[model samples]
Target: MSEKNRDGKRSARERLAAERAKQNRAEKRRRGLIVGAAVVGVLGLAAVIGVIAAGTGGDDGEASGPVVAPSGAQGEDSLAIPVGEESARSTLTIWEDFRCPACKSFEQAYSPVIHELTDAGQLKVEYHLATIIDGNMGGTGSANAANAAACAQDAGKFVPYHDVLFENQPAETDDAYAQDATLFELAGKVEGLDTQAFRECVEEGTHDGWVEKSNEAFRSGGFSGTPTVLLDGTNIYQDRSMTPAKLKQLVEEANQ
Candidate 1:
């Protein structure tokens, strides 16, 4: 080959080698990113577990009294009131306060889709009650209402009674829920929920300690505020673009 042709061929070979090296470096970077991401995910999950364990382990001794979790409550420390089929493929965890207007708004906006998804056996909800409003607004309404809901859970009418509470939710400052009568009257809206046992449970605040404990869990979990909603462990409510329709789509995709 001529000298010129030799140089051209050598340049072509050099270009090919450079391209291969670049590709190799890119692959290595991609692999590193994936491994780093996996480590971060694992650490995040471990942190969540640690928070939950610490919150409910009762080491703080803040929520005084017996931790009387409601019957049928599930999950860590029996703090979750589960709604929907257990076999559902996806789980939506909600941390809410009965006295929270934002929580009421959340229920109004998403309960329909939630009900539809639960009814279709595509999703299950683990409701975690919080009493942040009581502390923030200075009243026991949050705790009282949550106890009543737990009583309703005992009667197997929690869903309807829960909706009833939100539908009849009083103003943030009213503290109307502080009265056992108000809770009972609301429970009356749900058939079979206003039984004598439920009445006594609400009147006596049967699950007050449990509600307090759950609220402690919420506080210690590093959550921002009420209606902290999570879909399959992701904080979906924090996503400003989220909507009921989008939630439905996500649940459906997860099922698929």
Candidate 2:
């Protein structure tokens, strides 16, 4: 072959190689973009699902049945404990696990009534945190969060923290209940909590004993599931569907 023809052929080969390399780089960039988009979509979907699950009540899945006060309850008035009448008649104690989804549902469902009652002095609700669901879902049960909540309670910030945790419950997965740095981060979002004190308590498991004792008493009282509500220490109702009307009815019936 002529020298000029050989040079032209070599140039053509080099140009082809360069073109192929450019195409390969473009393809790689496209693939990376696709993967990144998929990841973002999945994360966004997860956030949506978590929000819906947290907000929605799980009545169908709850272990407790429909709301029905015990028979022969002497009209709903029996349930009303007069507001601020604390002569052994003002307190309605509840034992619940933070990790228990049912407990979350119960809180969402009945918290309004409890709040109204508390505000009106018709009821004084004492919530005893339990950790019974910790081991059940392959995550840290309610113990860690409960302990932190108790610490917040000591700081007069329990209800706010409680609402935030319930509102931000992790999805039900292997790590759903794992207490970690994120929990402390969540606690920090609660207004008025001393972040340092809350973190210290969570790390040391300060309220572990309180949770333990509450669980022991709950078990002794025959509560196999979370969110067991008691009227004046008596096991009168055990339903996940304890709505405001039902709670009010029970309260009125009990007070009579």
Candidate 3:
């Protein structure tokens, strides 16, 4: 071979070897990124599992802890009171924590069905805001929010305030999002609520006892989690996974 041709062949071989090395490095980087991503995903999953397990106290399903409730509180006389219409034959009572994420999930999943049923006069929903998991799940803010909800109930704005509470749920902490100003703001969201009365009730914590009493009643009734739904007074603990179709079927069965 001529010297120039031999030089060109050598250069080509060098370029090919350089290309191979670059490809190897790129492959290593890709594998490292994938491995790093998998590790992060696993760590995140473990953290979430830890939080859930801590929240549920290890989930032994045994009520070994002391039952928390306010003293000398009687259950509400109209705990199952129909709110939609008198002709509504069935009642769907839900005991839920305002700060509980699972409760929020239930609301997102099942509230549309509730609206439809209420509109059709087939169902009336009575919400009993329970604060059993407030301190543990969120904080004092959860209890305060629950108190605010009860106050709204006093002004007959429970449903509207309920929606607002869920809408503004403290994603980081379970603090009351509807502060005094927000409470009045949410009152405006409801048609008939007297904003002044709602302000007074929330300020004085007038509904605090009621929320406590509801929590007590839920504990007495043997509920272990938030969003414990009652379809015509029968406890439906499966609210988390309950779909609209399944709820409709359950409601029909309850009616029968």
Candidate 4:
């Protein structure tokens, strides 16, 4: 081939390579935009849910009562309902909404591992309750159920009652937990949790202020959504690869 022809072939190959590189960069940018948009969508949804919660402002525009912390409640502002021994080497902080289906799913998937670790005195779980569902879906079930759980705490039946709540959690759109009778009925499942004092606590929304305050913490805390499981201050639930075995390994490794 002539020198000119060879030069032209070289130019053509270089142009093709440049075009391919440009297309690859565009593809990368497209993927980045997609991921970024998804994150923004979640944050935006959370903001909208927070707005709904603020608008509801308790049973009727805010729970009109004193902020009563439940028995043995810990953490800042007494918002954390703790489980397991205080001396556990690892602390798992969980912020959840009773009406949230995602929260229930997390509970179902990880509760056994959690129970095992807690039972072995290897981990402590600090449960922070939120009422975002009430704010988003328009009902007091979240607050009511949270208060009932607090009442259970007072009776030393928090763990079991907490499990029962999630086990029987109604659809996100259903306000079944809003009814005292339903909460009372569930309480019956746990021995010695259905006393008159428990009844009054649940009926009176004794911890409504506490639940509301905890939710405010969630909104202001910049969390993405429910089941914000932080193991030793790390947001493990957000990790796509997190699993029960992985959590167990982390806790065991931490103890070592």
Say which candidate scores most in lDDT.
4
> For model 3, how does the per-residue alpha-carbon lDDT over 196-223 read when each residue is reduced to its tens digit?
7667766877656555555556767777
The predicted structure with the larger TM-score, 1 or 3, is: 1
Can you write out model 4's per-residue Cα lDDT over 136-211, one digit (the tens) per residue? 8888899899999999999999999999999999999999999999999999999999999999999888888888
Models sorted by TM-score, best on top: 4, 1, 3, 2
- Model 3 stretches astray by more than 4 angstroms: 1-76, 79-81, 172-174, 191-194, 239-241, 252-256
Worst 10 residues of 1 by lDDT: 54-63
TM-score of each prediction: 0.76, 0.59, 0.62, 0.77
Number of backbone collisions per candidate: 0, 18, 0, 3
Give residue 246's lDDT in candidate 3 (0 to 100). 82
The weakest ten consecutive residues by lDDT in model 4 span 56-65
- Candidate 2, residue 164: lDDT: 81
Per-residue CA lDDT of candidate 2, range 174-244, in tens? 35445558677787787767577767777876655545545455556667677777776665455546557
Clashing pairs in 3: none
> Model 3: which ten-residue window has the lowest total lDDT?
65-74
Off by over 4 Å in 2: 1-88, 174-177, 233-236, 239-242, 249-256
Which is superior by lDDT, 1 or 2? 1
Question: Considering only N, C-alpha and C atoms within 3 Å, which residue pairs clash in candidate 4?
Answer: 57-61, 57-62, 58-62
Whole-model lDDT, model 4: 0.92
**Listing every candidate in turn, what is its Cα RMSD in Å to the true structure after a full C-alpha superposition?**
18.0, 14.7, 11.7, 15.2
In terms of lDDT, the poorest run of 10 residues in model 2 is 70-79
